[model samples]
Target: MKLKKVVLAVSMLVAIAGGTAQAQAQPVKNIVLVHGAFVGGAGWRAVYDRLTHDGYNVTLVQEPLTSFAQDVAATRRVLDRQNGPVILVGHSYGGAIISEVGNDNKVAGLVYIAAHVPENGETEADNGKKIPNSAHPFVKSSDGYLSIAPEYYHADFAADLPAAQADFEAHAQMPTNAAVFTANIPHPAWKTRPSWYMVAKADKIISPDLERLYAKRAHSHTVEIAGASHSVYQSHPDEVARLIEQAAQHALP
Candidate 1:
């Protein structure tokens, strides 16, 4: 009888230890958000709030839309500060940025939000060539920066948003360097990393067909948000946050 009690106690202890180990192996707690062209890190506020509220250590990368290398470096800088494994996420042109940096050892998974994903030796522009974005006829500055014309910005990029907010976003838009579009990735990270993607069906800034192609090529688990424009992150913050949460919950250890 004593032997039986001893064995049962030993088994319970082992079970407790196993449970602790399983809890420690739960999804990564670090999340890094990267924003795409013609936008800044400020756009991630809603998503950031949701993530942080859920106990995630979230950081937003402010990529200078100057060049691809610079943007990659910016993301790398943020990644360098993470304490443990990370779930990297990018939006719009930011997708291309994460595809380059997600190769870091610290990255456990990647999430793309209405963003671009280029293959080796391919530029974002090259990826979109087969099906052009409908938000074209961009306004170009003398310095070679590109932006959506104010008159068309709301309709093209944020139609789902309130008119006032869309107008403000249009005027406050960050123009991307034209050279950034032509820069190619030498090593696309999606080739190795597990990935997730959100497709904005009503996106005019990037053809939905192209988004699907990129997701399919990366073999990423994908979700399509109907009627969501390029600003799906802003218009549907709850859904975006939920997807990121899912990535965090399922990321490999």
Candidate 2:
């Protein structure tokens, strides 16, 4: 009887260990991407293709850029549709969007790629003033919308991209409302969620120093892509996808 009891106990321990291993191996499969101002979700095509090819359920949020609240609501709508825990990603002004919306219960982790990260009560505009950007002056339309000058867009936003592609991007501009910059995040999700950050070393639109400061403040797992421009996600899709994959792999469901 004693020998039989010992064997059963050992079998139960093995079962428990196997179950734990399987739980740990189950990676987060959903990914939600948010794009910044002056651009739309179309910019995420390359990154989306890569992650989708690798079997991730990648969804992009097409922000209205009408207001900060609308952008956050758009992201929340996308998050609501995710079937399971999601790895949220943002670029440029999109980071501010995620920082506000990532508080959703379905969010497992966050990935910021050359993005802004504002603290409680801080606006991206406030941060911009503290760490001024190198990009050429922004052009404000009569309606109070902003866009980069076509002549300087290539150099300031996509210097790493081919000239032809950058030129097309320049002309395909999506002007953002100036009012969007003045909005502040009340409770940033980065304070509680696991986060990863990629800094574009040569970014001109948003200062790399500010990127570093945000990463450091958030205690995020950070990587630097040397010589990358503000369009790092488009210019270095492989690296950006890999870091996002890392976040997905490690995030708990």
Candidate 3:
């Protein structure tokens, strides 16, 4: 009778420990990715694959490029659909959207991939004014929409990318409204949240110096990738994925 009682106690303890361990284990769930201006969710295909392979649920948001409020609304829509906490990742102009939308309680953390980290009431146009105009000839604004000039796509936006790949991205690029650039972000979420930033050292569109300034202001965990263009996520998907993973880990208890 004594032996049987001891055996039952040991089994219960083992089961309790197993249950606790399972409860404590980190859950792999959704990460909603937002792309910058002149691009759509399609741009994140590489990063999406990497995240999915690492056991993350991933959703790519296709911003309307209509205005800041619209973009934030679109991101919030995705955030609402997620089952667990979301890691909100944004690039370039998309960062501005995340800065506003990521304030939601559902957001686990934020990742800026060569993205703008604007302060409250600041607009993309305001930040762009601080940097000298890009020497790359591919960008143009007309009829209230901004687009990349097809000719300079390979050399300016994706210099490190193969000519063929660059050309394809250039061709598939989406046009954004110029008004979106001027729209101010009433609330910048990064100011109140833990954030991670990736700096594209070789970025020509947005100055590297400015990237440093924004990251510093946001008090972000930052990593600098050398020889990368503005589209560093495309040029360095693995590094971007690693940064997102780190951000997610930081959000865990």
Top candidate when judged by TM-score against the true structure: 2
Report the lDDT tens digits of candidate 3 across residue range 1-253. 9999999999999999999877646753779999998877887888889999998989989878887778888888888999978889999988888888888988868899888888867776778787754645435565767788878877777888899988888888888887877777777888788889999998887888888888999999999999999889988999999999888777645
lDDT per model vs. reference:
0.91, 0.93, 0.84
Q: Work out how many backbone clashes candidate 3 has.
A: 1
Q: Is candidate 1 or candidate 2 better by TM-score?
A: 2
Error of 1 at 105 (Å): 0.8
Model 2: how far is 35 from its true place, Å? Answer: 0.8
Residue 90 lDDT (model 2)? 97
Q: What's the true lDDT of residue 189 in model 2?
A: 95
Clashing pairs in 2: none
Decreasing TM-score order of the candidates: 2, 1, 3
Q: Per-prediction TM-score, please? A: 0.92, 0.96, 0.87
Off by over 4 Å in 2: none
Q: What's the C-alpha lDDT at position 162 in model 1?
A: 93
Comparing 2 with 3 on lDDT, the higher-scoring candidate is: 2
Q: Per-residue CA lDDT of candidate 1, range 61-158, in tens?
A: 99889888899999999999999999999998899889889989999999999999988787877777778988857888999999988889889999
* Least accurate 10 contiguous residues by lDDT in model 1: 121-130
Please report how far candidate 2 places residue 152 from its true position, in Å.
1.0
RMSD of 1: 2.3
